[model samples]
Target chain A: MKGMTIIVKTISSWVKLLIFLFGIYIVLFGHLTPGGGFAGGVIIASSYVLLMLAFGREFVEKNLSLTASSRLDCVGALMFVAIALVGMFYGAASFFWNFIHQQYLADRATEFKLVSAGIIPLCNIAIGLKVGASLFLVIFALSVFCNDFRCKGSARELM
Target chain B: MSDIPLVLPAFVCIPLVAAFLLPILGSFGRKGRVVATALANLAALSLLAMSIASTNQFSVYNVGRWSIPLGINMVLDGFSALFLITVNLVSSAALLFSVRYMEQYTAKPKYLSLFMLMVAGMNGVVLTGDLFNLFVFLEVASIASYALVGFGCDDEQLEASFKYMVLGEVGSMFILLAIGLVYGATGMLNMAYISKAIQNNPTNVVLCFALALFIAGFGLKAALVPFHAWLPDAHSSAPAPISAMLSGILIKVLGVYALVRTIFSIFGISTTVGTLLVVLGVVNMVTGAFLAIGQGDLKRLLAYSSISQVGYIFLGIGLGGALLAAGASPVWASLAILGGLFHLLNHAVSKSLLFLTSGSVEMAAGTRQLDQLGGLAEKLPLTRASCAVASASIVGIPPFGGFWSKLILVIAAIGAGVYWAAALIVAVSVCTLIMYLKVHRYVFLGELSETRQQIKESRGSMAVAMICLACLCVFLGLVFLAPALRAELLEPAAKVLCDGVGYADKIMEFSKDMIVCAD
Candidate 1:
């Protein structure tokens, strides 16, 4: 499929970065805010989705290839597991133990800070990465059928 | 034993990690499939090991070091341990079988990944101590199975998947609505806390409504008679190994196990619900058996048999519950529950073996219809033998796993003074025998069809998986004869159910350590 109109392309280009940054903010500050990995990840994925719509699939593929996103999805999930494993190994702690909370980060002053909440924020980042990549892949895979949908127009669009 | 608690989360975590990584690994060309297979096998094997090692061990792991009733926890009691063993054992065998069976299909890695996710979900369902988390895990297993059911992308597969998905989602909706009502009534999502709340105020109308919803929801999942429309299509349409997984253990874990846990442990079993289960069990037994005798499709017959067998398990459990509600001797109640749980384990092994044999037949003969396939005893010796073994077991022939369990059910019924139930058990066994005889006569003993002359038996991993489960079907009856093994493997599980709402106290006691650790 060809790219959308120049105006749509230009506008999406400028707005995509803001959406990406906001998603990162949501992920990083997830421990203290309403938006955590899941919400933030969807937001980030939407930015890429917007890029796909405005600049076309080829452009988005060039920027973030399917293989890379797929790899990132695995890496993010592995990172979460690693954090939990590390917690287990370091202290003989239970699964998902908050090592940071029991140690240096215990002070009340650090409770609401970005660097606080032990491994929770780290977990949020990992989950955000995985969810974003997964959503993108789903969107990308679905979009591969766009040609069929286009040929059949509104009739097959419901499929 | 102390380390067992720490290992509990690994059951859920390892599978999740493997599932996540499989797709990326699969992208690495020819070597990727091998890598995915090795990784999945390792994950499955380790889970099997842990479940076995943890047979007698009991503990609960608190998430994020949060105390129970606050943060989510994973429990490893007798009941969950038995389920863990069955799930992981079947999973490992199915994964082994899939390595060969799935080669005929494309996207092997995606298949393995989804398989791992399903394992993770079932493990989570078996282990989680919180209500909402159980729901979450149940959905995980359900969605993965839904996808796997339609994995072939054939018209029939897609249609079957849609049917299964719609019904499954409706079941899930009932469960979620029940959870919401439960939360509203008790103001808790943790199962133990909810149990504690219900025990303190045992007369809430909303909780009773929630109990009704739970039965309907989990019953739909278990595919009890009235709600069993989706099983035959979905089971028969999916790939063979997956059909084995879905029909063998998935239904048990997602349906019967969940239903049993909620009914007995969470809501606390009473005579009313007990009688309800007994009635449902009898109806499903009669209906499922009659339906199975009519099916020409091998997998469809096994699916109906699954419903029928599940009815037996429910009957035993329900009789136990009724006896308990009547304040009868604890011995009779325990014996009934034991009979039920033993049947559950027996059926899991035999049914999966049956499905795998069906897969073998399908793989070799290129057809599942009993009318089209014949004389597999000559062409596919291994499959025929294993099929015979599993068939004998399912028919409750003596010395096999199914017979001992069925005998226990009869004895339990007689001991409970429920003579009619005992007679029903014997009658069902006879019907089950006739069905299997038909299977043996038509599929294995008759003359081979002309077109199927060139058919070949499934070799290597598929044969190995079938052989292993068939051996289990033959030898599992020893658990009844061996007192020590029974005490270690099955007794603890039966005890948990027998304790009823007292599970709340036991879990709370285990959580005390976590609370101390947290401080």
Candidate 2:
């Protein structure tokens, strides 16, 4: 698809990084704050979508690519499962045990600290990556289909 | 605190990891398909082994090592175990069959991934002790099945998938609304806590409203008569192994098992709900069988037969619930539930076998149209035999799995003094017999058609899967015939439902350790 107005394109190119950084902030502070993995992920995805909107689909595709995004999606999911499974290697071998909290950070695991929540931040990061890639891919696929729908529609008109 | 059964999470974890890993491995080009197939099969086989090896016991596993109020719990009671075995058995057979069967389709890895996701979701649905988690898992499974039904991307497949999605989403919405109502009423998401709340004030109007919504929602998912519009098209249009999974286990787990769990364990079956279930059951059996008799497509016929057979299970359980509520002897009540549980297992085995045989027939003959196919008995001897065996079992012939379950249902009906329901059961069985007879006459027994003269039976993996399931169909009755096996498998599953709201007490007793842990 074609790019938007030059002004919109220029503005989005600069603003996208801010959106991405803000999404990362939300994901990191998810355990303490209102917006968490899913919400942050959507925000990050919108940043990529903003670039696609400004620079055209092909421009974004050249950089991120569908296959890369798909791979990232799978990687993100496996990462989350891996994090959960890591707890199984520790004391008592429960599926998602917070061994770090109990073993090393016991007395110091205070509220309002960045390191207090052992795995929640990691889980949030994984979830953010997955949701962001998945959403971008979905939107990209729809944009590709929009071309086909137009052709099909025109064919119907001719008939 | 009790030792957490680490194995409880494996049921959900293995399939999930396999699902994501398959696509990555599948991207390995030429060898990807082989790797994906082997990995998927390994996951399924391990699931079956785990289900079988896991003892029939009650325990709860907490997620993230959090206590009950903070994190979800996975409960492995008799009810969940029974479903776990059925889901894993059918999934293993279907996965093995798909090794060869999926060669007809592109995106083989994607298909396998979706299959595993569906399995994982169903396992989670059965294992979860929390209501919201059930909804989430239900969505995961439902979404995967929706994509699977239309995997072929054929015009008809797409149409069926869209219709299924719409109806399914509506059903899900109803469930969400009901869950919201339930939370608003009881201020709890854990099923045991909700049950405890209900027990304390059983006559709350809001809770009653939530109960009605739950029935409507879960009833739609289960595809009871009024809500089964999307089933035939979706089940018939999917690839054969997928059809097998859908007909065999998905509906049983997503629809029937969830509904029964909600009513018996969470809400505690009242006379009204029991009667409603019985009425729905009667309607489902009659409508499904009658509709099935007119179908020309083989897979469509089996799909309808699924709805009809699921009805027998509902009737059995509902009769038991009604009897228990009326304060009857516990023997007759447990007997009715036993019949239902047995029928559920019987249908899962026989119906999947039937679908697989139909798949093999389609693979060899290149058509599922009953009129276009004929006389495969001599040419495809093994498939013909498997088909005949499954058909007979479904028709409730003397020795197969379905016969014993149907017989139990009849005895239970008579015992419960529901003479009309007993009569309806027999009449529906006759209708089912007529339907399968039509299949036999048109598809297998007649003179060989010229176009199918070159058709050969399905070879290798597909053949082995069919053979195994066909054998299981015949031998499954041993669960009932062998007293010890019955005591182990079916009896305890029945008792879970028979115990009703006592499930709350059991879960509470186990989770009583959460308070101690929190300190």
Candidate 3:
């Protein structure tokens, strides 16, 4: 498969970065705002999907391989679990125990602050990475297997 | 007992951590396979130990130290412990069997990961005290099973997966809708609060409607008679250990157990609901047995038998519910429920062994068709012996686990003066006997087929897994014969159901000590 027309490709290239930025913003501010890991992860996945749409499957595969995405997905989940376990280590707290805002942590995070809410931000970030990579991998594998979308002609022929 | 509830969440966590870790470990080369297998085995064993250790202990763990009725809780009552033992025992065995059984399939890591996820989901379902949380965990398990059913990627497996997914999703929708209705009416999602609300206003039309929807949804999930179109196909097409999991405990946990818990403990049992269950049980028993008699595929036959056995368990429970509703002796009700719960344990052990035996036969004979398999008694001695043991148990032969449970059910039904149900129970035992005889006559008794002459018995983990379950099948009956074990394990579970709506009261009482306000 080949890349799309110059107009579509150029616009997508600039828009993809902005979309990625927006997704990060949503994930980082998830504790204070409406969008959290799941929604933000989806937005991030869509940006990659957009990139794949403009540049074709090959270009994206070159940037991020399947294995790397899979590894990242696993790492993200492990990080979340690790955070939960860390809470347990502190005074034998419950599973998913949030201890980040405890009196032990030098200065406590105040209300409405990004660093507040104990482990919510960390959990959101882990879930964001996991859901994003997972969705991207799903799309990537599906696009790779999808024969109908494969080009039978060069980019110039259809345009 | 005070500290026991702290381990409740670990039941969900351990398998989850293993699930995510397996894939990462598998990304390494050949050495990763050994490491993943070791990790999976270790996880399964530890879970089984924890389940056994928590037997007969009840406590409620508030999530994140939040107070109950305000935050979600994990309840470790007798009912949960009974099902937890069944789930973890069968899952660990299945995982052991899969270590070798799945060698032929690519991506062993992914398979184990999915298996762990399914276990985690099931454990979560059994342990959760919230309604919506049940739905979420149910989804996790259902999605994993759907993926597993299609893991083979054959046309038949794919078709079966699609059909299972559609029906499963529909079932899930009904459950969610019911949950929504309950929440709308009661303004609470905690089961204890809902039960309390129902106790206060016992005759709401919407609550009744929600109860009806729950029956339909959970009945479909359980695959009782009318909702059983997917079981035969999905169970037969999946890889064998997975089939064992699906047939063994998945349906029991998600379908039968969930439905019973909702009806009896949450909404409170009634004569109408009890009669409804009895009727459904009779229909399922008759239908599943008749269907099994006609199946040529070995695993398909066992799958159908699963439906029949589940019918027996439900019949016993329904009889108890009916007796309770009639304001009869609580002894009879408890006896009936004891029979039901015992039969649940019996079936979980025996049916999984049956499926595993079928897997062994399929693996060695290279076919699951009864007509094509022959004289496995000579070539596959261990499988043949274990299969016979499982068959005997399923058929309610004397001195085995199945016989004791069936006898209890029959006695309870007769004592309750439900003579027809008693007769049906006996008749179905005979039907089960005939079905297993057919399996024996066609698959293991006849002269070895020429093409399968070179077949050999399965070795290593698969053999060990089957033999372990087979031994349990023979000894599990002793649970009834032995007073101490029965008093500790089976009796407590029966008491939980006999107590009915009292379940909420107990949880509420326990909640006072465990509740911690989230800051």
Candidate 4:
């Protein structure tokens, strides 16, 4: 299917990068702020969604590719699960222990440091990647199934 | 034995890890489907082994060294352990059955992945001590089932999936609202702490409201009479193995186990709650049995029968609770609960076996219509025999597992002076017999149909799985008969409920001395 109008394409193309950066910022500072893995992941997915809207499903499929994004999704989840599993054996902690902070929190002069929360931020980033990829894959899958019969309306109507 | 507690996290962890890894690994090699199926079944097998090994044990795992009343914890008490076994055993069999049966469907890797995720979620729901965590895991399992229901992608399957999803979401919303209200009242999300708080101030209006909401939510999940509209369509439309999994153990875990645990262990069963349960149970029993007898499709008939059997379990347990609350007789109360728990186990095994046989029959004859099939006793001998065994158990024929549970329920009802309940149990048993007789007369005992000229017996893993489960169904009857076995297995589970609010005291006792030092 063809994409939307030139004006819509032009604005989304420029705005997508800023949205991606904003999502990364939220994910990175998730341990400190309200927007964590899930919220940030949704934002990142929306940026890709903007790209798909501006350039059509074919463009996104050609660029990111379905299999690559799926692999990315799995990788992100595995990374998070690995982090959690590591906590089980690390130090004398239990499953999901924040061992990093337990050992290193005292070394910091103040509590407001970036790496202060041990595993929380790392966990957040892992979850953000996983959720973002999964959301994009879901939208991509849904889009592929919407053939001529379903998407009879014009791109202008969608706009 | 000391390291047994470490096994708790692995219950949820192993499945999640396998689910995620399968998608990636399934893309490799010429035998990726083989590899993925093997890994998925390995995960399920290990779960079954672990649950059996950990039976009758009580322990708690504090995640990330988070202490009780704060960080999330997984509890493996007798009650949860019982559910753990039920979930894993059925899952192991279902996964094995799927190994052969799922060949008809596309996207084998995705199906295996979703199956593992569903296992993980059910395990989590059964084990979690935190109420909110229970909700999360319930959604995990529910969503997987929804997607799995629509896996066929046909109009019928998609419609069933949509119906199930909408009704299920409504139940979930009610549960979440109740959890929120509970936290508002007790300022705690942990079930044990909440129970303690409820006991401390047992007269809170909000907690009472929350209890009412809990019954409604969990009852919907369990598919009691009023909330059972989605069960028939969802159970029949899904693939056969999924039908087995959903009917056999999913409803019990999500609905009855959760509801009973919440009511008995957390809120502490009272006369009002107990009566409500009995009413719902009777309605479900009467309605389900009647509806089942009229169904033409084999799968639809079995699905309705699942609802009816679940009623017996609810009826038995609710009878016990009512007796316990009235201070009339703890003897009959324990007996009633024992019957209920036994019925729950028996139904899980038998119903899953029945569904698997239906799947086998459907695969063999290319139809689940009772009239189109005949004389399967000679053609698909293992499947026919397994279906017969399951039917015998379900219909409460003597010397079978279902007989003992039904007898126990009837005896408990009579001994407790609930004559109407006793009468109702007998009446439902007759109805159950009639329905199964219909299934047998139409599907297995008639003259061989002209369309079944080339019917072949389902061999290999399908036959192996069916025969193994059929053996388990027969063997379960002896568990109730053997005094030692009954004392070891069913008693502990029933005792957990009989103790009621005493559950919180035990949990608090276990978590008392352990405190993780913070920096």
Real A-B contacts recovered, model 2: 0.69
Candidates 2 and 4 compared: the better one by lDDT is: 4
**Which structure among the candidates has the greatest DockQ?**
1
List the candidates' TM-scores in order. 0.96, 0.96, 0.96, 0.96
Where is model 4 more than 4 Å wrong at Cα?
A: A4-15, A148-159, B516-519
Report iRMS values in order. Answer: 3.1, 5.0, 5.7, 4.7
Span of 10 residues, lowest total lDDT, candidate 3 chain B: B510-519
Query: Which portions of model 1 show Cα errors greater than 4 Å?
Result: A146-159, B513-519
* Chain B only, TM-score of each candidate: 0.99, 0.98, 0.98, 0.98
lDDT (C-alpha) at residue A87 in model 2:
92
Best lDDT among the predictions, by candidate number = 3
Q: Which stretches of candidate 3 lie over 4 Å from their true place?
A: A104-109, A148-159, B515-519
Residue-by-residue lDDT tens digits, candidate 1, B150-239 = 998767998999999999999999999999999999999999999999999999999999999999999999998889999989989999
User: What are the lDDT scores of the predictions, listed in order?
Assistant: 0.89, 0.89, 0.90, 0.90
Please give the TM-score that candidate 2 achieves against the real structure: 0.96
**Candidate 1 chain B least-lDDT 10 residues:** B510-519
lDDT of 1: 0.89
* Residues A46-83 of candidate 4: C-alpha lDDT, one tens digit per residue: 99999998889888889897677888898889889888
Q: DockQ, in order, for the candidates?
A: 0.58, 0.47, 0.46, 0.49
lDDT rank, highest first? 3, 4, 1, 2
